[model samples]
Target: MDKVNNFELGIIGCGNMAKAILSGIFSSGFLKPHQVTAYDVNPETAAATEYEFNIRMAGDLTNLTLNTAKLLVSVKPKDVGAVTDSIKNVFAPGKNTIISIAAGVPAGFYEKKLNAKAPVIRVMPNTPVLVNKGIAVISKGKYADKEDLEFAVKVFAGLGEYVIVDEKLQNAATAISGSGPAYFFLIFKLLVEAACDLGIKIEDANKLVLDTMEGSAEMLKKFNSDAGHLIKMVASPGGTTEAALDIFMKKQLDKIIKAAVNGAFNRAEKIQDKILHGD
Candidate 1:
């Protein structure tokens, strides 16, 4: 357990995202229980997690991580409105770095609401964090210094790969990674369902999908060839694979993929501008 020096880790809203982070933190052994504090609206969740992690849980946000360590706000976006008002009086501006994982809630929004000069780092982490295979995209706010950004990076890195992008790229990253797991899972589900419809047993089809997907990914790791070349190699001319490719091409699958991605981007923008703002 190589514990990192300086700053206790604190988490607000000990929900799924918080739990995922706690698991990562404990497994990494980079921080100790005494160094972590949490508060949640759900008393049961707060109590259970506190006991399980052997960490302190504050019943109120006033006595929670905000009063002690660097804070991570993992509350849902809609619930952020309540949270902002609740923590306003308790925030210690210079002493704590605030990291928020709520989607569509900009760091500017928090700065304005909290009325503090605390460094804020906005993070968009996907549900895959639950399995510690998440992809997180981070963007720094006005007051967040390099040290603060580095600290946020270290925390999220324990969950999975993380990238720090410019603020302008945050929305795109959110669309691609934040919502990407659902898109990929939908594709996997369709493939498995189609296989079962084609007379393959459902269980076998699922296993086949899982194994083939993993094996194909492994192939990419082992081969230096680009995806196009690897795909070409697998798709022999006038063979079943080629026939399938021809059908996909005829159906403009590439165009469909692009359209799907674009749709997600457009929706993400709408979520930020319209839903979050009531515009």
Candidate 2:
């Protein structure tokens, strides 16, 4: 399928996450190597990505749309202004979808910067995408339509799981699946540290924590059981698990978690505000 239904993709940044997406899509046969192009401010990076992915090196954004494109802006939020200014000046209007994987900044920011009705799609993908086990949250801009949303889903489906949300809920969704990996990582680290503090060897503690986590996650997926159900199943009336859980509850672990997540959600909001407003 040349251009994957005539949908050439121009990636504006060739970073690690951008490479993860390219790997997933190429592996899934969603887009052939020749159908995508990589552009980066650093020619070295652009050349490296081109050689690695066997994709074309885009001289400019305009070249991507010779056959109509879904230009994927995979840059950092701090660089959005520079990227958007470049695209706004040189990129063609219509016949192309602007898909951004930048966190916190909404599609509106791009549209506003472009100062035109460019079809924009926003997605938040976590680092697990590097391992092909990530989840991405997708949302459409005012100019994006059903077909855009469908294609976006197909684009990210190879990564793992995906969910579509209204643009209004994009940041909230981001606060979870987008920023959620770090939360788990932090908790896992703490568990390991606590176990080691209790005199368990590091290696043994790692095995215990990792095996327990993997099995627990699998149970949630396999049995489709809520976390509460799993907790109840594991914590018998006066068991060790119950004792630990009681201590956690007594320390207001649940409230702390809620507050942490809420803080993340609000920080996401502030990030957007900073993107749209400044400093």
Tens-digit lDDT string for candidate 1 (68-152): 6578898877888787778788776666677989888777777877865767899999988899989889999889899888888
Off by over 4 Å in 1: 1-7, 275-278
As a whole number from 0 to 100, the lDDT of residue 170 in candidate 1 is: 76
What TM-score do all the candidates reach, one by one?
A: 0.92, 0.94
lDDT of 2 by residue, 182-201 (tens): 99889899999999999999
In model 1, residue pairs whose N, Cα or C atoms come closer than 3 Å (at least 3 residues apart or on different chains), thus clashing, are none
Alpha carbon lDDT at 9, candidate 2:
72
* CA lDDT scores, all candidates in order: 0.81, 0.84
